[model samples]
Target: MVAKGFTVDLNKPLVFQVGHLGEDYEEWVHQPIVSKEGPRFFESDFWEFLTRTVWWAIPVIWLPVVVWFISMSVKMGHTVPDIVFHSGLRHICVTLMEYSYIVSFSYQTKSYWGNTMHYLLHGCHHKHPMDGLRLVFPPAATAVLLVPFWNLIKLLATPSTAPALFGGGLLGYVMYDCTHYYLHHGQPKKEVAKSLKKYHLNHHFRIQNMGFGITSSFWDRVFGTLPPQGKDVKAR
Candidate 1:
């Protein structure tokens, strides 16, 4: 069955079938299992996955690294003002790197899997934004990328600077997760949220290439991908 504006090809063999009911009767039946599973409890799914895997060790993994950076900064005896300024600039750089990676992925490939990965990473929310259990990244998948990111920052910046920047970047991810979850599940009907919900829905229902930003539409506006106001954008 088609929901929202997406088309469902039930005519495909995978979705069409024949069934027998009894020794005396036989009939054709069509039933499809979309995806693999149904909704799960948000907290139960999150904590259960987090506690069971080595990937769950991510929060602990960075602690020592963060502590070492703070120690190095203190040992350097830099003035508070100098420390603050450098830290702020480094954070901006980290944020830029995080943003750049997602945008670059969009430009680098035309494969459907590449597009699906993007959706799995971020677009899934737009598709089923209110699916509460899927709001957060699975810890196992998220940890795979964290190490490479940390190492990249280490090579480009001083030990002291890298942690501060990484900290800010991590904070950005947290904000992204929280805001995205709220955008989908929160009940606020205020103008801003209403507008945001509509903007996000358009991305899912109409133009997938446009309106890529979630926490803020700054990137969409900057990249000239923002959807037109007040008009229904049709999907490709």
Candidate 2:
């Protein structure tokens, strides 16, 4: 029987099972897979807990860094050419683009690496979509990605501008993670959120290849991954 988009495979031993690990360790380690579940991999509770619990502190951890960068830039009289941070519209646009880039990167990794990368970044979610404990981005994983991202941003822009851009991207990530959890667990009063939930759910159930965006569908539309025109959408 299928529960929350997963089915147990009787033919195979659960992933992460090793000889002589004992029943208690075995119970905690094994995760069953459904029809579309990707390859099974070992997961450590210590690491898993660290990732799941870090969500609450994300804003506190990153927002101050953004403020510091902007303030320091202003103090040092450093600014990006052709872009003024004072403009509300510009801030919004930059933040959105950065956020969209992360989503695009995720989709591209899945495409390039297939199930291996998907299992690392996204397929685990697809396998156990409703598991609230696993909803947020792991800090360990983020740190690995951010080091390279930080270097990339630094190369592209001035110090003053890079922080703000990075901060915006950070905020974008926060939004994406929050929105992803919400779509799975939130009931929205607004039509936009309702629509977003519908779009995301379709990605999970009806068409896994499409609708990669969580915070917004802008990238999905741009990348031609928008769900099919007549694809059935269900809200749950």
TM of each candidate vs. truth: 0.57, 0.67
Residue-level error in angstroms, candidate 1, position 230: 1.9
- State each model's CA lDDT, in order: 0.50, 0.58
What is candidate 2's local distance difference test score? Answer: 0.58
Q: Pull out the clashing pairs in model 1.
A: none
> lDDT by residue for model 1 over 1-236, one digit each (tens)?
33233333434321111111111111101121223122222235554444232222434554455545555666667555655666567555544554454455344222345443444454334334445566566656666777897798799887766666665556556555555556555665676776666665565556655776666677677778777776752211
lDDT by residue (tens digit), candidate 2, 1-236: 33334443534432322222232222212233333222334456664456353346666666676666556556666555422443233346644564454455344221223434444455456656766656677767777888887799789877766766666566666666777778887888898999989987777677666777777787677778777777656666
The best candidate in terms of lDDT = 2
CA RMSD (A), model 1 = 10.3
For model 2, the stretches where C-alpha displacement exceeds 4 angstroms are 1-44, 78-117
Instruction: Name model 1 segments beyond 4 Å from true.
Output: 1-123, 189-194, 231-236
